[model samples]
Target chain A: MAGDAGSIPELDQKKYDADEQVKIICLGDSAVGKSKLMERFLMDEYRPQQLSTYALTLYKHTATVGNKTVAVDFWDTAGQERFQSMHPSYYHKAHACIMVFDVQRKITYKNLANWYKELREYRPEVPCCVVANKIDADLKVTQRSFNFGKKQGLPFYFVSAADGTNVVKMFREMIKRAVDYKQNPGDFMDEVMQELENFDLEKKEDNSEADEDGLKAESPDLV
Target chain B: MSFEAKRCGVQFSPPSIVLIYEHKETKTIRKRIIPVRNFSKYSDYSMAAERLKNHPRHRDYLEGVSQSQLEKLHIILRDHMQGFSLERSLASFNLDPDEDLNKLDDEELARKKGQMDELFEKNRRHKDDPDFVYDLEMDFSKTTQEKCSWDEESDDGF
Candidate 1:
């Protein structure tokens, strides 16, 4: 028994040495305060206005979850309607998602289904949180938003990006969930892993010549 | 899924070469991919090759590459580097002599100048004030009406 225990792989030790990385993506319709919410959480300051993101915006943050230091990569997408049809490569290796909808605009709320559909297609089992942003403006659609969250079986939060309400708590919860997902990855993540395997196989077939270099250079456009 | 819905209509090509080089200071192995398309520009190829060669830590990686492979890569790079200029020469070979090359009228040019000035002023204001907020009252009113029909058909309008 002692010999067998000694031969067991030290997975936890390896994970601790290699700081875990988690990719969190923010998705929503245009003008739904996705950028504002991210900026407020990252900077801890209320940005009254934000420029519409054209491409992907990355925010790297390190946080201590449990006993491990996890590096969180937050990908904020351009909420413009034209950019809604995102490339599949954007969803590769994502751990979690925060889908936001504006409380004031009913259109933004209705567009949640479309955004969720896109996320599910690429990463079916990744944990997602529904955020109803700009709650400082109005509360009329509160019940409807709550119902939507319940229907999706996702954790929901009524956040005010302008007032810095519940932003920290929401992000903390996201980090915790991401850490849990990474540690076990259970049956839910099986499909995601299989899809990733298929993608890797396709990538290998595409770059047979470059295999000798042992360096995989990603395009700036993909980044 | 339907055929139209299943297809994204976008094709992406993978990078050609992966260069594994050690960092001079950290001694950490860094992987960089050099795409075939980037070789089209002579300056881009020269700069990339020069940086890789000058780095002290990349000596071992460069030395490990076979002489034949290196020569092959150089030939491909040279072809790509010259390809752009060759295409440019071919494009200008048959120029339409009767076409109106300069088409802008004086009034149109002045209007464009006014638009540019307005954009410059707006940009200056944005630069000066970090907390500048755009007037969203009209947009709010338009989007928040009881029967607000969100325009889902046209993506370019916003």
Candidate 2:
């Protein structure tokens, strides 16, 4: 059990009608091999697209959330662009996040605090799963505990994107929590983000319709 | 049971061919995103386009599209992968009909060749084509002479 990470509602964020889409974002230091983990999660059901506009990739996955199976869209980044600081806009419209780090590298683990600091800037209330990736390399680390996730009250998981360890299981739980938090976003969510601004669900064309479909509008040069 | 290709474009970030189409019967517009896998800057655009056009899951949706059009999209994606600027890649497609391809560099020539192939296919009379003429004749003489500059003034590539 992730230990009563909180289900009680406090603030009312934008609520979705049943079976609405969920946008999940993933961020971490560029330790390499996260794609292997994505493959583990997507299996043959996915085709990873390297987006050109930014240092990110969008993946399409379907997960069972409650009775109806809902579509979950993930926006994440990898490669050399990750060596630079990730743009804050990466968190825009994100319902939840899966923060991953290479367990073999203590520094990647330590850097989570810095990442979390920036993450709080935009999303302070979304449910985040602190994932230590590449545990297959060192089995002993799975037995160890990390204070970062515990101190922040975030759920923690030791996963192996290489061996498919807890990858699926961890995502399933994250998806459900994301849906719940999106509807309520109250007490269960960290209260810091609620005060920042109105949970504006603007159907504005500022990439709103495009974000819904992850498809670019017709304006981009298509030569 | 027919579809019209409304628009065609390529997403360079996560390299994929995005097609906007209209379902002929219902008049509903739909988009299909076909991810390009295992391709690099140096990949063969023809092979990649052929594979995608023949892919079972995609072939039906791609039925109305010509192979050369898909090849053009692949070339643009390849340009992006090869780190060429968008302006340069797009310029390669606005081929000058009067320009001599023989004098072009390899990369530029390939792009021009691709355009020529598409044009030729569009005009070629297939034996199975409904209006296929046994001996086709055409008059393509220009009716007017036009002046042109270095192309710095306009976009028509004239």
Candidate 3:
């Protein structure tokens, strides 16, 4: 759309049904290749350019999940200590989460624990995937990152977003799993809504009783 | 939740309005300590005023400071921070200056905008060059206003 030579492929609108769109968020430390992962998956190519995200980055990509095509809202969050305070909002109300760590950087892998912890505490039900990014680096570096992911029992994948490795495949699988899970979000949402409705009804009933008591006191023995 | 878990400690609360008065002649800055009775009512920015109002400590904090005292505090803090002028700072980051809405009404906004635009333009021309380190510092400061928007109040609200 910006008149680039090798433009990114747009989604085929005909493939989608009229159902709701599934939203997935991508979050991790800065320079963990979060934007590169997003570019490779959504744009199908990566530029050699560098752009530092301040607080948040948003991208919308459409991918087919089963028979219906879903539009996923991917949120890229800043990973500095100052930005750590902003992470909860991105984690809040997320449907699916991806915690990315750079294979070459050990500290990035360590920071994933905080990302995982915050996601669990804020939105426990959201499914997550841990990514070992920049795998094009040395094998020894990637191996360490993989071992860390295995220890956490998180479904891990090694991706080189620059060269367009398993990034697209991983995202496709994420959408499929999300669509499958949404087939029945179950009574968790329904039960919460019902409880809220019941509380409102109870409040209304109590207000009416108070009104009746006030009327009776004002016109005592009139009947 | 246990009492300790929900305990609203003084340190766990939001940051207070930090005022630093600068003397041009001496070039020294003095920090002023403003008492905040209701830590919840501390407004970091205008965008999240509603969220701050809804905070549990907001009411209690308001009770601590009278209306006139709060206004005085606002003026003191604002003046101390050079008006906390987002317009003056954010102008450097605007790529297309003419397209900008110029929402800030500061008297120095236009002059600051011109100076920042020139500096940003000069820096942008070299930011991508591998040998350009000094220009990157200018770029770094330009984006720092966005970092302010990520403070405690804006994050929890927006």
Candidate 4:
């Protein structure tokens, strides 16, 4: 393990059993504090997730859902900001989604529709959470209601990664919902995904290696 | 299930490559704003273009688009991010080779240099070409009365 990875905790080797692997993807415009939220949730302090070797880091967060530890892969594709419509693979088989927007930037909040629209295009039924980030910048805004999440009937959160307010609560609830979806999907989307992959595409498969290979093959653009 | 590329454009506010296409199955017109990540004013337009074209997930959707077309959009995005006006950037399309590149700002000069490099690559002849000759030579007509600063011969400079 690298020195920096130590400061960021890892699942205990002795008890690490990824019986249920869940992928939680974060979607937002450029500089919307998506990484900051993930960093804050993973570690005590918010440290910008680095991509020195593996492009963007997929945080392996170990969470307990119903007494069974579930290994969750937190997706924060930092430089993957090329399109308002994200790559479908970004939502491919994703269990849950975190849609974030910078509270200070109104445009980011306005663009949530495009992000959510694209999210539904691929994964129509995944549990999604809408986050109003950077509350520390102006805590007063939290008192106001953002109707995007309410209209869509998705869970909405007011989080501040900087001062660490409501970050834990938001992530914990997201994990629980994702695990619930995995155990008992509300509709046929899960079955369709399984049919498409033709595999269980479930807990036993360790996606770390598969994803690492994918990143390794991704060369510097224009090369 | 398939998308046909109708047109492509650049979005400056968020630095995105907007692709307008029609869903072949649904017959719906859709816009996919592909976000340009980790890009800056100093980012290489061609490289950025290639990166977007070859992005692991994005490449599949961008397959129908042309590389040159994508490069042009990236150039425009880079120019806008560098604070160049739309007119000024568009004006580069019809570059006057005789224009004084020295008078241009650093960003403009760099862009012009990039254009020159691309042009040079297009016209460059290699030894393996059909017209390749080992003893290729040409004679140039001398200027009438031009005496540029570099023309002066002095012992001080090599």
Candidate 5:
């Protein structure tokens, strides 16, 4: 419902035909409300005391953009570090990611850098969004230097998971970006397994080539 | 009958054979166990044993199966307290413990960076809106499964 465009009353079945599928992963520390955020965005419901995702939970939604429909695959990853080992499986298929943090807890915001650092080790250039959750509480304003907007160099949305504000707009933008990426042949995936297999090897070659290219290349292989 | 598992500082009790397997690289072997209830004893034992034998990593570790080993295994399965021990699963890749994982050309790394950029952009646009708020809405009524038939085939959070 978050990505829904209008309230015309009549359902447009034709728009659903041009759907492009995208996978978005919600990742962060335990008890950060990744699942709840997702539920709020997709279903517009809230559960205060829900169990953290033990493995991975998949949620599907279809958003109509103009004449095309976008199918979103939201993969919720478990927050614990022990469970972090399973991240590769989920990230392996992810097209984009939403790293969530709790605004009330400074430590949660501090860990955003680490999450970014870890995610940089793998994936291609996929769009990311940061969420500062739990705005319903009074702001202590201490140690608030962790700017959600400036540090990540990405889109950021502050929302109250409890009160339901700005959550829909945030997800709508995500779906739009996902849909844009999907329209490009280079991004939408079908034989991703094969591509992943050769990806590391390709990076190794590119890295060595970058050294020889001597920064003249438009984008140096970061690896 | 009792089945219990103790490892990594936590204990779990399942009503069937407790197969405690460890993985090292391609090799995987059942190293320890605490069997509590064995409704289908032979099938459970055979399945566990077969998993060990067929595991890609631990095939060499099986070696010869002596009569004494079989007796020990049976005793461990029959008795509630007696069980086996196994080493923790080890990764084959010799990665430095302190080495930053960002050096790896894994796909997750790239996606995260992009996600960060997107978050920054979103925040810049809506950081000060007074009406900004989070939403929590779900259709929990859609779930219709009233009965659960737990199956051994279901992976244990693999």
Candidate 6:
């Protein structure tokens, strides 16, 4: 091994140059404190402002994880319908997803299934973590709210964006999980579950029927 | 000897179940044979049964299902549950049909184009410049000014 002492420096340089880039997407309904959680985790400061992200906002941060430097890109997405059309592209190539829901709002908790459905449709292999944000407002969320995650076999975290409680812990664990997933690709059971949920054995008759109905109804020249 | 062994040489060969239902839109009846193993990775027999009951095509068929037919379905599904391995099942599924239909209309396209142009204009000033210190400070000042103006405009909109 000492025969290649001169190559040690080159190896160190190559390792430094090959830092892993992990893309993590934050998804949830509007006003669920997704942006606040991201800002609190990245900047260690949270300010209440009229923050309405119209499109995908990218936040870049570098961290050292177990002797390896990782570049983490957090994509904060707008939950409004105006930006919904661009979601597929935003979710494309994402390594991990963080689905946030407000603990105080039952509607946000119920909507997690829809968000998860869309996430699986786009990136089935990627791991997802559900975040129950604004826990400071309500320390107790219904156990039923978490049954969805349990059924789907997803990791869940409860945090408060306002007071910065468990925000750092959740993000660090997510980063480590993402890095481990990237280094050691393993079998994903959740992908199988998602596939089964989306399976439809019906024939493709809806498309042809819709096409014929549209053509007959819209063509004035035929009349 | 087991029933399967007495009938055939196989140890546990369960009969495959076939379901016939009429398509609501096309008014055509179709028959589908259920897979003996791996009914679904996520759903159990009860969930699949619920889905079948709620399915528009199978609604009529399920409405008139006799007690014997229901018992037969349950028995087949219970047998199928034995082969439901998460690791062995195929994980591929079709993407949402509506996802492709999310095309932006002309008005939305024009707005997006305007936003892109604004972004390009904001970035065009600092392109092709190697002066690190000067570019960094200038970009910082320009970004602050742009944020101030954006905040004012957004306040007005609100």
- Comparison by DockQ, 2 against 5, better one: 5
Candidate 1 residues B1-158, lDDT tens each?
A: 00111111111234244566555666566665544445443433334455544456543555433332333343334544455343442233222323221233332222222332222222222212466343211112222334323333423211
Provide the TM-score of chain A alone for each candidate, in the order shown.
0.69, 0.74, 0.65, 0.71, 0.66, 0.70
**Stretch of 10 with least lDDT, candidate 2 chain B:** B149-158
Q: Write the per-residue lDDT of candidate 5 for residues B1-158, one digit (tens) a residue.
A: 02121211112244222334444554544444333333233444334545544556544433233222322343333333333331211121222323333233322322232223223323322323476443433322234233212212332110
lDDT of 2 by residue, B19-57 (tens): 999989899999988899989988998899999999998
Give lDDT tens digits, candidate 6, residues B1-158.
Answer: 00010010111245344556655666666665543345432435444555555567545555533322333354334444557333322121112212211245432332232332222223222212353121121111122222212122221111
Worst 10 residues of 3 chain A by lDDT: A1-10
Write down the RMSD of candidate 4 (Cα, Å).
26.9
Residue range with the least summed lDDT across 10 consecutive positions in model 4 chain A: A1-10
lDDT per residue as tens, model 3, B1-158: 10111111111123344334443456565443333433233444222323333447443333322232233333333333454444443443343323312233332333333333332233232223466332111111222222211122321111
Candidates 5 and 6 compared by lDDT, better number: 6
List the DockQ of the predictions in order.
0.02, 0.01, 0.01, 0.01, 0.04, 0.01
Report the C-alpha displacement of residue A101, candidate 3, in angstroms. Answer: 0.5
TM-score of chain A of 1: 0.69
**Candidate 1 lDDT, tens digit per residue, A1-223?**
1112112132121222233888787887655667666766766333222223335566768888978888877777643344455554445556788988766556666667777766655555678888877755554433332445454468878776665567677888888887777665564445445444533422322222222121123321331
Kindly indicate the candidate among 1 and 4 with the higher DockQ. Answer: 1
| lDDT tens digits, residue span A1-223, model 5 | 1112212233232332254767777767654567657766765333222224434566778778778766776777533333333333354434577888766445556556556545543444456777777655532321133344243356766665555667787788787876665455354333233333433324323331221123223222343
Candidate 5 Cα errors over 4 Å, as ranges: A1-19, A44-54, A79-86, A139-145, A148-152, A185-223, B1-158
Which lDDT value does model 3 have at A56? 51
Q: After superposition, how far is residue B25 of candidate 2 from its true place, in Å?
A: 52
Going through the candidates in order, the fraction of native interface contacts each one reproduces equals 0.00, 0.00, 0.00, 0.00, 0.08, 0.00
